[model samples]
Target: MRFFDRTCLSSLLGASLVAGSLAATPVLARQPDGPVDLTAQAQPAKPAPTKPAPATPAPKPSTPAPSAAAPSPLAVPSTSATPVVEEPDTLPVAHWTLADAQSLLATIRGIGAEGLFARDYEPANLAAAIKVGEGDALDQLASRLFVWLAEDLRDGRTPMTARVQWFAVDPDQDNHPNAQLLAQATETHDIKGVLAGLSPKHPDYALLKDMLSKTKDPKQIAMIRANMDRWRWLGQDLGLQYLIINVPEQELRLTVNNQIIRTYRAIVGKPGRTATPQLAEQVRNVVFNPTWTVPQSIVVGEGLGARLIGNPRQAAREGYVATKNADGTITVVQQPGENNALGRVKLDMPNEHAIYIHDTPSRQLFAQPQRALSHGCIRAERATELAMTMAILGADLPPETAVEYNLSGKYTKVPMTKPWAVYITYFTVARDVNGVMRSFADLYGRDPAVIASFAKPRELHTSQRKSNEAVIKLDNPL
Candidate 1:
């Protein structure tokens, strides 16, 4: 299969693009009240250090800190000062000992176990530099190679061009800075251990690695490798509690302490322009008995507004409130009711995509095997239960209060005392809800680019953390 169009490949092979620096802005925490404001929040600036902090040894991968606050929006720059190096000379060289150089060469040579090619790091060149007996040449070559390997392990091996519609900003680099890792590796001479620490902390990566070792078929190995790399694209530690939705699997999982607490069937965006984009967002509020403001595309283009304006009785019966403006435009809102587009609850996670998870009035849609049915947003099955659970877990709301809010048939927004991370991910090869390893159909045909990237030489990591595609706000649940 053709992985990329000519235009896309041309852009990928062209000069690396430098991402502009983002000015940090303060974000004010909002109280749970009316509808959620989906504005993007900037990451606050960190204070400069007066002296270099002691380099702490890398810790073993454990459950992520439960109380850590959600990260800033995808557009927000990483707090880590790790430079995106386009060339070997771009990075600062660190003094390398002969022993450390030997260890690094061995680590690079055996990188294939992590689905990375050692040749990409120029292992031969590093070995030759080591033969010349530890000098600036050896230090410079080893440092550059180490940075490249660390970047691939921490961020991902796939270039931005191959990752279609992906907006999830990985925070691994911030957690494990490349320069810091390089220094730590040289100081401790534990080259392998330091680099190995960069692997994604998620269990799925380990499982995929195991599968890769056992699988004999070339195709299956490629699939496993691609999925393994997908894990690296996300944050190393995916918090103590989070919600993960696998779009192709049509599954939503509520995981706590690396175990699945609950699973919900999900109806994701339809394939094509409305196909759901991968995202990493935080659920800030839970809206019970939510209202739906009809978009102009539906109100005008679909003639719903004109019809509602002409038939007031019908509009009222359908739970629609219509108003005619002086500008000859009509406004339409589907009031909170059983027939409302957003069934009983909505998880408010503000981002530029305007995508949210909400209850669906059409419960039968969940039963269909092919659930790529919505415009863009996720239509969750048993949404009231999900919302109640989120309210109790995130907002510390009493179960009774949550039920009351759901049954009250009135709008209520419960702000999260502790916002939970919500990941809308697309994985063609992954464990099903029942914990069975299997492959789902690539509903959006996204796997080819990633699989193809694995076959080609590794590309330099760029400043771009996400796809540069224009943000398409598809709010309509239908």
Candidate 2:
């Protein structure tokens, strides 16, 4: 199977703009309701080194090896010829460290999110999104967006101990970004110069809200503030199509172009023992007729009873096939088929947590608002269709190949030709679902700090707001 990835975001900070007095100018940039301050240092993009491709010429055909001296007597035969340096594995790669991801997140000190928010693109966020085609840069960009779409509660299920998702946009390129960027760019460029110009009074939303209120380094703050603007101000207003879950509300929503398409009840993981960790990754593929592997924790713990009672026939009953390893340790694996615990499909978003999104036979659980009952993974309602949608993201996929799993047990590999992104987001502001504003049980308890950020007293606009962070309040408390 071939795999690739991409994001829907691009840089949005335009040339310096003036405050106020706006005329419909190039890419109408909307005036920010208030000043955007910068306290934390900006995260500068570092150029990555590229590996030069080897210049080896094609090898000429060789005569067959002699019988006695063939390779080696005890040498293990390579399972694969010209073995790839990267071992064949089922795990997803996580390149960003936790700290690297946290820098993009926001704190309660401000109203704006720290990383790229939908508001940045203003009038053009959606338009600009369209400009980003199926390129490698776009995939990296989308991966970054994944960080914002999904949250990592540090629950045992997912490996993102620090990174988190905040929004629920579509997992497809159905929406455009270039258009959105144009709309926002027009809004800001029209008011160049008069605007407060990213200052302490502006209170840059990156780092914590009080970053400027605490630090007093202008040079440090200036550069940091600049990137912060680019990151925060410019965003896809008609956000990407994604699956958003509000941890604070215990809700799940699928969105398309800012409009929510579906809402469902979800159970989050309990805090500590298996906190629902904030994570950002894409659903690369979906597994059909999936089987549940009782985690080691379960196998070694309470599940042993069920394993003993169920292990013998667990393969057939649970729709799995059992096999003992050379070490005599029994293992049960499930293949794609009806009656499979995974329902019909499962999304593959590799993270430290073996957590994944899959169809759940237990549809009733979705009705419950506090649905954090799984070991750590998410049991999605209508997950089979969701998988189908992922397959559809791969435009080249023959419609039959995309849905073939429903017809048979064959594993389907659909490469994203147009680039589809899946985000397990977590934003609790509500409004997107178009349903009555609902709150959720904080099963993972991610709100206290974020909620506290709102309640924390303010510090008078401090020189520190400029760049260097010392952790002080900005603006005198009311």
Candidate 3:
């Protein structure tokens, strides 16, 4: 089976606005009190500018005899001079003593406690690297382990292993300079503490770690491991406010300040070729009562074109408009209505896959326990509510306006006043509504790839891992 990646399509489709032939200026959601005028205010207007009165001339001073009682200006403290106060060093530093190295080595040996394989950190080799009285080797070992610890903490096994189309954003892209970590390790002499500092502090990460500690079933443990690693695939920070869709669970959540404010049931792409890919995009706007431009694959593959040609009356009855091209091909479009595939509203987030979050007439599908039943695009259960929420949160629209405005039969677009980040991801395990950790079905079969990646042997020592890091490329001197 072939997979259609949408990361590239996002760039191409993003260049053009989704207005179609509609006006560039979308009708703004009406404010209850109408537009504000900067001219009017409760405070009185400023007084008119007045010319200053002519300045009085100063009388010349007469020379006076020196008086011993008069104080000199030099006797006062100099205001221009700034006192330098030495600041105490507050930064954590590493103290790479034999004891410190052994402490870190203990954590490395117990890596399995963190839902990771202990073998991945090379126990035997690390044991050999941290010899007592070998100061140079101990220091080198500390640096190497620090680099490995940082990579595992920041990115989790390589991205390619998970087959995710991820791009570094925000905190993920922020460089974690090894030199700084190494220098701090040298000063603080707390190798274990320094390594712990590198781990992600997100609550979900902590929850998974807690779950890992108690989980005994190998299958469940593996699932948790996969999910934990998936978090590392995403950037360290998910932004102040963003939307995340879990394809496997068929759910969408609007998170603000790390709290989930709203959760909506979603219909994700079907398994196999139509599976939704893991990616990151930004929701730019909402299209109300949008027209569906049927893809040619659907037209020809589904025999829609031939059916329309055989019975022209069906086109009008189904709200389909067929346009014959110069090349003799026909293009079919479904008008906005209750029967429209994209229901009454659609969230606009351009991507190579031509996927978006939108309303769907097939609301009954949401009632099913398993909701993997879409053709790439996500069909939201509470599309109108989600749209209205987005309008108030990102489009600067009043709640009343978002709720009261009627779509009727028009194709209206509401551009976001401020775009919201949206991430499409896949995970086999996560916390449910009741906060109970649960495992989900691998609808797209992504778990195996992630699980396999974790199975790959890690670089034995920190120096080898750092030297082979993709973030650090050594160019040919030629």
CA deviation > 4 Å runs, candidate 3: 1-103, 132-135, 162-190, 301-317, 404-408, 459-478
Could you give the candidate ranking by lDDT, starting with the highest? 1, 3, 2
Residue 381 lDDT, candidate 1, scale 0-100: 77
Which one is best on TM-score? Answer: 1
Error of 3 at 387 (Å): 0.9
For residues 1-478, write the lDDT of model 1, one tens digit per residue: 0122334433322321112121122222322111111111112232121121122222111211101122212222323333343433257468999998898888877776787666566665667778889777777777877887898898988888788999999988787887789889888888889999888877778866766656655566677778888998999899978999998888787776677666788999999999999999999999998999999999989999989998889999999999999998999999998888998889999999999999988998887778889998998877876787788778888655766787788999999998599999987767665454667888898887787767654666767889988888885787
Please give the distance, in angstroms, between residue 399's alpha carbon in candidate 1 and its true position after superposition: 0.8
Residue pairs that clash (backbone atoms under 3 angstroms), model 1:
none
Per-candidate TM equals 0.81, 0.45, 0.69
Candidate 2 displacement at residue 83 in angstroms? 46
In candidate 1, position 272 carries an lDDT of 92
**Model 1 RMSD in angstroms:** 17.3
lDDT, residue 77, model 3: 30
lDDT of 3 by residue, 89-171 (tens): 22222447767777766876666655555444444545665644556545554555555565576657533424543332324
Alpha-carbon deviation at 52 in model 3, angstroms:
86
TM-score of candidate 1 versus the correct structure, residues matched by position: 0.81
Model 2 scores worst on lDDT over the 10 consecutive residues at: 152-161
List where candidate 1 sits over 4 angstroms from the true fold: 1-89
lDDT of 2 by residue, 213-238 (tens): 34344333222322233222122231
Alpha-carbon shift of residue 317 in model 3 (angstroms)? 4.6
